[model samples]
Target: MGELVYGLLGRKLGHSWSVPIHTALGCAGYRLIELEPEELPAFLAREDIGGLNVTIPYKMDVMPLCDKIDDRAAAIGSVNTIVRRDGKLLAFNTDADGFCFMARRAGVDFHGGKVLVLGSGGASRTAVACARQLGAREVVVISRSGPDNYENLSRHADADIVVNTTPVGMYPGNGAAPVDLTAFPRCRGVLDVIYNPHRTALLLQAQALGIPCSDGLAMLVAQAKAAEEHFFSRSIPDGETERILSALRHETENIVLIGMPGCGKSTIGAALAALTGREAVDIDAEIERRAGCPIPEIFARGGETEFRALERQATAEAGKRTGCILLTGGGAVKTPENYGALRQNGRIYHLLREVGTLPTDGRPLSQGADLAAMWRERKPLYERFRDTVIDNNGPAEETAQAIWRDFCAYSGD
Candidate 1:
């Protein structure tokens, strides 16, 4: 039927390895395209492109762009893969199914387990759908914003599995978790969508207390494989799934360092990279590289508003990398766009230290500020955003070792 035209469109194209990986799978006709939101409609009009994969910023937007959405996609309210059937756009969500496949592969039997889910976003919806479909007894959602606010969680809590779909515990810092697991009695398993840090803080803490946990990598690969099936009109062989997953393993689990300025995000990130045998990326450094100037210069030229816009762009670009440690700016969570990207794309960690531990002139934000008051105000926010909290009150080596222990336990590796 002529060469099948398969492609993907998104703003930041740097972190994507879908092209090489998909091509390696023998879908040579597929083409990956990077385009802005404004360019999507025009791109979809092309008869040459048979199907498409949508990522970030556009997963939800593409819903209206489609002629029809599958039931699962309709229920979850998000779409990541689309197929053109008879000149009509057919939308489907592989995320929930992908997560279910991974859970089964990991030997997770949620049939009778009590479940807890963190956050109430797109991923959480998929997780809920999957859990309910699997016959979980109950599923509860926890958020810093309050239970009443997250109606999805309220409807599902008595589940056997606990899933985290929020950005808490992702790299750049370590502190806070989406749900207060302490409140729940016990769960059969903990599932975290944050894969970057390999074993997120939530997973680590759960493991530390002797709970079984799994990261989002398996689900990501499973969904990616499912998407491949849609693009090729055939099932992906089991052997190839293992091969691609193995390649992705080392690439997806890098340390993500986040905290206030001078909290050693960049320095510690480099060291962590060296020790972990993964590449390190400094979001600020990359922004400087792209902006052709230092961060201070960017701020001076465009003000905080402009700098934040640049930060969001940097976060989006960082989200596409297969495996790498990322060090983000102190205020990366201040913007909803950046926060959403972090929630969807990586593990978040918040580096914390007592006011007495500060070096006086080290951090820009620490200047002329009340340590206790600042901590009080920002602690909850950090807790709200992070999957785990690590006390930077100790040596960096000790901190890294603690992080490693948490990862091994959480990932069950």
Candidate 2:
């Protein structure tokens, strides 16, 4: 009855977006409560717990602690949303509802289809239950040691839908996929519960295969919306999910620009920053700042290899940042490792300009280098790295604005 404590409960929550999400939904001061296994008991016993959404290791842990459990959560054997009223704790599994919403939004039909869920944890449980409820003819839970494990994924080649509930391709381990999506040629839909990277390796593979795929951001936001409704004892219009989703997408997804040397990446990046009020991070400038000298000095100090090493480091650091304009040097796409670094949180745009029109000032590789040959060599790399291509032959501001329009319209659904 006293001041209510409202937030997400988990073990490690250093990079959670829950606070911003709940705040945007008008849940002022909603915070993250990181606690160890030993501390969970005492924290749950507190008299002031108005509501809390659980995650990871504690989703199942807190179920027994609750005084009452919703039938859906009890049926799923997972409880992620908890509310305290009349000094009694009641738990629910809003994850199921959230998952269903995400799938439906992505046009993933569960009716009369086989669903292959790629984990055995709480999330996997919820996914399985929802898939069944949504009319999935069969649901297979795949775990490491289970009979239907990774070793025998070919058995599920007929799976109509694939849902990843594991953290394999989650942030920090960006490109890891639990299973090769190619194994399931009949997979009509793919959903990953890992939202940080925007696109996971599995989802990316699905995209490449021309399968309908969706990232987990919609699920994350929808789950938060359900949790907020439980917290406030009020209903929120479902449209709010899409609204918050768009805002969060634009705010968290990085706008990365990659191009040949002096193709107006820096200029267009600055223009984008001005129009959007976001910071423009030049990888070249960051390398210079970190090395306490210019890029040419770094190249002079060592060679192209040293400069590339430094570029990799810079790309890695900049890729981790949320909601910024990242301008990469010309040679950034040359490094294969930089793709995962940039794709983790960015929508990369390849800025294309006439090779003859590019300014080669102070560029190590571009200084009297065969510009045509360089473009021919690097064109495939740029094409591989980019989500979209923008022609930079016009004014920088116009190109930036055109990119802004496309980026705004790109709903990674």
Candidate 3:
């Protein structure tokens, strides 16, 4: 028959590179399908769909819908990969294998290493099992909700390799690190499975200690490759896989600047572009170019609805341009379509500043306006779209440098 038709079903598990990574494998007809809980069964019933990768909330729920469970998946009590054979659903756990592969590839010596797992969830369990299988001398699970007998030791003193499977240091909360590395002495390695932030607080702390660390990007690529193998019943070319992963990493870590009018979306965006050698696109300028009028005039003549429509179009167009810093209008998040489009190919950074910090004559929109009320109203929307929040109350040049540094760190540039 034709190449197997495979895809994934799950919620929008923020900033996942699953789509690009999977598509890069060149697995013939493989695709990723973002599905709501109610839409899965009907989608699965399709004849052309050969298999699927299930993530997050649907991982456990999908088990009941499977016709058979691989022994390892049953033992692990989770499913991440599924293949359809003779109209029967077979569940498998590629996550464990993926983790093991990544650890080894990263030169982490698991044999006799003292492993510390930072969570007790399904992913943590998989990590613990992988560590043990790789010959870890001891595996300790550390979490506030861990077992009663769990001994929480400082990473500074005890662990050889610390793996964070929890979502603490993930995007939107990139500043919240998982463990205090101050306690752990001379860690050999660290790994965090949250890939969106690429370089998490835990990884940064480890790097600061001169320890070799890795983010979830490699694991994600490995696991996606494994899923592709199952879905296609064939192996993917190694070079193609690497190229796709490189592209995905570059795209996902891109800085997306959002804020209200007079918030320096264009100025700061250009600064960031100059600092990083990346192209910068201002949505409003693009809108103005297309509409042949200024944004305020567009809003005044056609009202907010028409302006939002233009914003959606601008955001969608911006997503198609790679390696560029995108500056969105302050109200872009008000349109789900625009927000979704922006997030499709980039990470969002909310450039925030207190109302009192903004100069009165900054922009046309801020003219004769209630600055405090406007800032307050737009704060929540900006927060919602931000993967990281950078305060713009300081010097623009310094802020640009900081943003550039964080971008380079996040992109592993």
Candidate 4:
């Protein structure tokens, strides 16, 4: 046999967090394996195969290939984890355990709650099985062409819990909710299996309505932990799941700064990047780079409308990046579309400085503009966009340190 291989198998995995999650769980050999449909059989027949965690498009395809499948996996009709021992492939479904862990961590009580699972894929099956296992009173699967479909969502308006298994709001397609939570007056909790954005549109709406919600990171980590146990035939402490999740969030989440044009966002962003060892991206600067001109020049060329278009493009590109410090132009928040662009991979912090202290050197709108009036007009936007507010009234480094402290301590809750 050649060297044993262990990794995650998927069709497309550019955004997967499984590598880091498994590595944190002590699997040094863990990696991501992107395979086409035809490559599946040949890869599985390899003699050096050790263990693997399967993902979308392959979860059900590998079942018939497995020599034996645990009852749980058999019941769910899906297998996301496989262990190759004695020349036989053993299959198991760890996603069920992961779904349960995610719900419990978010305090989403499935006991007696009617669940509306969104999708008819492998992940949806896992959610349905786990919801039932957690004592869900009734579980309904809503699919595109099913009896209970998106077109007739009002019929399930009394659903107590909404679990999204589809990739509707996944990254690069961010902010597309599968169903409107407001339509479900009785929705007490929301669970989205897309972990990249950290907050799907469904979860955001749930948050707006004061409903409990959780992203899929916990489920991803928990499933990885369960897969690790199966790989090594050993038990891992439950505490390890949260520990790794926290560390991953701290490492991957972006620190975004948004506020008035001259509220020290750039200076504070640089300082925060220095403190946290993350790259600092100024959206205005990026726009200038793309436009090959300065901000004032851009405004001079095509007015506020043109500047905002460039700013929106810059925000979209910058927000797709992970673990960076993003500083936005003051007027960026005025455009409603910029919210999801920056929020896709960031925790926004609004920087506050005295209106009199704000500089207007090359800022077109701020130059001879009514500073106090600007503040009055933009305060609500800042408040609506910020996850936390930091006073830049203090030293830049001190403010940056404060932001670092908060970012580190934030639970992404």
In TM-score terms, which candidate is top? 4
RMSD (CA, Å), each prediction: 10.0, 2.3, 10.6, 1.4
Q: Write the per-residue lDDT of candidate 3 for residues 1-413, one digit (tens) a residue.
A: 66556776777754555766776676555556777888778876666668788776677778777789988888877888988878788889889867876787667888888888887776876788888888999998887754621354633266788888888866555446777776677568788888766666677667557877777877878888888888768976656545665666765555788876666677788788778788888888898998999877897899778878887887777764556788887778888656545654466778877766666552555778888888778778777667787878777888888887776556543
lDDT of 1 at 62: 83
Sort order, TM-score high to low: 4, 2, 3, 1
- Return the lDDT, model 1, position 342: 53
Query: After superposing candidate 2, which stretches have Cα over 4 Å from the reference?
Result: 286-294, 297-306, 411-413
239-295 per-residue lDDT for model 4 (tens digits): 999899998888888999998878899889888878878899988889999999998
Which candidate number would show the highest lDDT if scored against the true structure? 4
Q: Count the backbone clashes (under 3 Å) in each candidate.
A: 42, 0, 7, 0
Error of 3 at 17 (Å): 1.7
TM-score of every candidate relative to the true structure? 0.56, 0.92, 0.61, 0.97
Better of 1 and 3 by TM-score: 3
Model 3 segments more than 4 A misplaced = 1-5, 27-48, 148-157, 253-413
TM-score of candidate 3 relative to the true fold: 0.61
- Per-residue CA lDDT of model 1 for 98-206, tens digit only, reads 7887788767788876666676666777888788788777766566587543544445544466788887765543334666555455456778876655565577567
Whole-model Cα lDDT of every candidate shown, in order:
0.69, 0.90, 0.74, 0.90
Worst 10 residues of 1 by lDDT: 148-157
Which one wins by TM-score: 2 or 3? Answer: 2
